[model samples]
Target: MMFGQTPVTHVGVDPFNPPNPDVWPATMAPVQQILREGLDLGPVTVFVGENGSGKSTLVEGIAMAYGVNSEGGSTGAMHHSRTTESDLHSGLKLTRNPGSSKYGYFLRAETMHGFFTYLADNPSMGRPDSDYHGMSHGESFLELILNRFRGGGLWILDEPESALSFSGCLSLLSVLTQLVDGGDSQVILSTHSPMLASLPGADIYEVGPWGLRPNVWEDLELVRNWRSFMDAPQRFLKYI
Candidate 1:
């Protein structure tokens, strides 16, 4: 089959064997939404929410179901540490494009240290791995993107802003833009950064207690909160 321009096009669960609501991830609003109504994806998909709002979990599930390593690595990578991943991927139904590249990478912020260690232990082909450990957090992240994230495939990231400075986030956006411009790459990013949510051509979703819903950058709670804080930090700080 000829490779298509998109990777996974939608994510849902089989109603006949849907995840139990009593379970942890299924109890989350976003997960529940996915179970009921699968998410339709685009070239760039951004998820924004507060902490513990299930955005990260939803992203992780999609990446894992798409066959990327749960601990943050490329497809078929064997970089495992203590598992905090939910079982949401176990029964996920991914609607992949008929002929998209199956290759993909997961870059979870909290697990990147271990992923770096994994990369060092298993360098690609004849080349030795770059010293990702030697670099500072932001430096390593940018280096990883520059070094590994070329070509058309899926790129799933969970809260990458955790390791990035404001400038670093912009750099990340540049790389993603280049990937999408190639017309065969799809990006799924769950982030607290308003900058990332503003990626051109991205379909933004706001994950919250009400479940995930299509949203615009200006109306996102995360964006509004950041704007409010930046406009007058004193208004919020006075409560402390």
Candidate 2:
């Protein structure tokens, strides 16, 4: 890796000898496909899936295999509070682009609070202190990316829409676009938000019982569902 960039070309678990056959992700069709044929990553990859479809698990495993902290943070982060993650990472393998970055960061909205505490507990040297806990959830996310996401590296985010508004997601999209445009960075994001899935120049994958299949943003089931709901809220609302 060239000082800063971590472009992973492939990720997969052992097809014949998985970490656990009866486990959740192992039983998922998408993950099973990955086990058979390791997933290939692009400069920017977006995964849209229904809940419990194994998309998050796949992203987590990939990030973990790339050496990012499981709980969330940079590659060297050791902020572990619990072992809630599955055993997928233990059996996953990553193939990085030769001379790209080896370091990266994992940002999952659900773990941001703990990650913030970790940063607070172990302050970096010679940097101005910014209290992440004091900022709004969206503000903190943008701030963290602005400060830490620079130069070149892989940035993996899981369901960041939990903390971001429409504009906030747009801001994140801009930053991510710039990162990839810098010529040595890459991004892998998983989200249910159609806005996030519509990131320009991103390769979108729809994960479901059918497995991980590529599609354009407009053709994604996620996009169509959101569009339908928006077009007729009562159609969905009346059922509820």
**Predicted structure with the largest lDDT when compared to the true one:** 1
lDDT of all predictions: 0.89, 0.85
Give the TM-scores of the predictions, in the order they appear: 0.96, 0.93
What lDDT, from 0 to 1, does candidate 1 have?
Answer: 0.89
User: Candidate 1 has what TM-score?
Assistant: 0.96
- Among all windows of 10 consecutive residues in model 2, the one with the lowest summed lDDT is 1-10
Q: Give the per-residue Cα lDDT of candidate 2 at 153.
A: 88
lDDT of 1 by residue, 36-73 (tens): 88888888899988899998888898988899999998
- Report the lDDT tens digits of candidate 2 across residue range 1-240: 121344887887754456776677688888888887888877888988989888798889888888999888888988999888877887888878898877799999999998898898888775654799999999998899888888788899999999999999999888887888787898899999999887777889999999889999988899899899999999999998
Model 1, clash count?
A: 1
Cα-lDDT of candidate 2: 0.85
